[model samples]
Target: MSDTLLKPHPLDEATYLRSLGPGRLAGRTSAAYWNMAGPFGGTTAAILLRAVMEHPDRRGRPVAQTVNFCAAVAEGEFEVLVRLVRDGRSTQHWLVELVQGDVVAATASTVTGPSRETWSHRPGAPPPMPPSQALAPLPTEGRNAWLGRYEFRFERGEPIPGRASAEAPAPALSRAWVRDAPPRPLDYVALAALADTFVVKILQVRGDIPPVATVSMTTYFLADEAEMARQGEDYLLCTADARAFKHGFNDQTAELWSAGGELLAVSNQVVWFKG
Candidate 1:
């Protein structure tokens, strides 16, 4: 009957945290967002951000977060250790770590601060793309469990069906309409996860799913809570691209845009792939 007892959506359930003590919270992995090896890295990042959001000392909204995947997180209980690094008049900084027993599985640095009214401009525009309704949703029934958690309609790059033998590599770019499968209103938490949903750029460029892991990912939230809520359940025009792949590492950058063309978030990551 209390708000605390309400059952959250699958995405929220995956990222849900329960206060344990000062600066600590408990959570568990969910089957809904399972990836090839572990829970989706995005969910991991979201939960870390959630810890900070729920912290008593938190201020403002999420400005940015950098999640570093230290090791594979096994499905089970985990503890998040949240440290309030500093709280300034306008900005709050935090350090968070996800611990599985004795080992730290992931760590994050986050910034939360109020957005002030100011002159703003973005030079780049959301790339042109057909309406989300114009394309068929990517099939997800038999793919990774996490794939079913979202709806993806590609306007430009879709992952190759399988390995490709083309002598030339495809351009490492994809533009698509993306949103939660069950249609949750946009929020910083949802935006954080959506920012990670771009099919890893290596799959888009090389046409093969290799043994890959995102070692580090950083997301910058541009839209404030009111702006995100105004998006309702509309799909975000999301895009991802890679600059280079060499020496077993690849660089990827992505942008998420609201249906009305507001830039919601920007993300970049370093991926390690094995042939």
Candidate 2:
């Protein structure tokens, strides 16, 4: 095969790893997902999860993952160390750390397990939105590189910096159709990264970028492998909103629904900010 055909996709390249030893791997940040001060938080989370998923003892699929941003990850090589906290018959718990030099830049915990057949129901329905083709994708030219990685079609609450002020605070709510720009198939690693694409909820309310960092984020994957496979290259309906912004911190929640209206994932995050 030609080398060109063997090349990895940008997302795969960004999350690619080289095993240094058991439970330890090496990776480098990608410019494609760079943010203001460091790599985009989503890609950071994706690589950390990738470390665990690539582990030999890993079982089942991703069920839940929580990542804590301890320090801004500088662009360059880093190390991911994964530890199997507990390996149960039905569930496996993992602890992972992303280290650049001696400083621990980020840490994460993940849960993976097999699914059992049982009765299920989804009471909450996907929010109403026109088909993805009906709306234009958010323009990304000359914006943050990460913003261009995904195609977003806002149904409501397009972020306009400085739209909110003390006298009038806009609600921090948004609903949109979102998918990877190059249309990658849905999977746990991609889903984990996509879960973090929402603009911070506080940004929606304040309508501006502040000195903000996501301190912690948790995502729960509801779909199994078969479910994710069925969602190939299709837009997922995504919605994000925040309840309050005070004490230099805020919280946001989001939901991702498949094109067919099945709830795919739910994510919540806590962010610290400064004026």
Candidate 3:
């Protein structure tokens, strides 16, 4: 069966992820969607963050969030519990856990704070990305169901999962322009998903796909709601690369930038993979 037959519009999926009450939320999986194993990690993180955002006591926007995948999340009727760990005048911290039948499938911690002018500097420059019109859309035929849900135009190091590289996996990187299919408005929620959407970079290092799981991940938002709204459905530039891989584990770092060159977010993750 094709994913198109089972997947609903992304916005509908996002709305359904909203919390039912204070620190309480629920969700079901789509039969049509699958990522190497269970549901997508990005969506799981977004749903956990949504729980905190829906909390009646929630304050400020999300400045940073860290999610730990304790175990695989089984689809259908999952519950998320969010707690206000700390509430301060300028910042709020929250803890969330997604439980499936008494098993703590995943947990997340978030820091939300008011926006203030501070000494700002971006020491790194954005990668030289080609105009959206200049690159061709990455084909999604015969791939994971989730790949069909986003638009990607790769500049280098495209996801050739399950295939061996010409030589060795020297340049473990993937740079592209990406956005949701049917184009959803950019938001912290959506941005959270984008952070983990790329295929595991370690696959590039090993020259083939192996058993892999993202053990932990953290994302830092540099822009607020206003910045997300300004971009509408436009595609954003993204670059992901692995720094080291050894002992069945690897660390990867990624950068996301607006088409206009504004640094949007930076993300890092640790994944367990078979050597």
Whose TM-score is greatest here? 2
Residue pairs that clash (backbone atoms under 3 angstroms), model 3: none
lDDT of 3 at 216: 98
Give lDDT tens digits, candidate 2, residues 41-152.
9999999899988999999999999999999999899999999999999999999999999999999999999988989987999988999989888898888898888999
lDDT of 1 by residue, 1-275 (tens): 97745767789889989989999999999999999999998899889999998898898999999999999999999999999998899899999999999999999999999989999888979998888999999999988999999999998888865544336578888899999978888888888889899877777777777899999999999998778888999999999999999999999999999999999999999999997
How well does candidate 2 match the true structure in TM-score terms?
0.97
lDDT tens digits, residue span 1-275, model 3: 79986776674574355557766778776544567788788888888877777777887889999999999977687888889988899999999998889899999999999888788887878888779879999899888777777899999877766554536565878899999887777888888888998888866655677788999999998887777887778998999988888888889899999887888899999999875
Off by over 4 Å in 1: 1-7
TM-score of every model versus the real structure: 0.95, 0.97, 0.91
Could you arrange the candidates by TM-score from highest to lowest?
Answer: 2, 1, 3
RMSD of each: 2.4, 1.4, 3.6
**lDDT on C-alpha atoms for all candidate structures:** 0.90, 0.90, 0.83
**How far out, in Å, is residue 220 in model 2?**
0.6
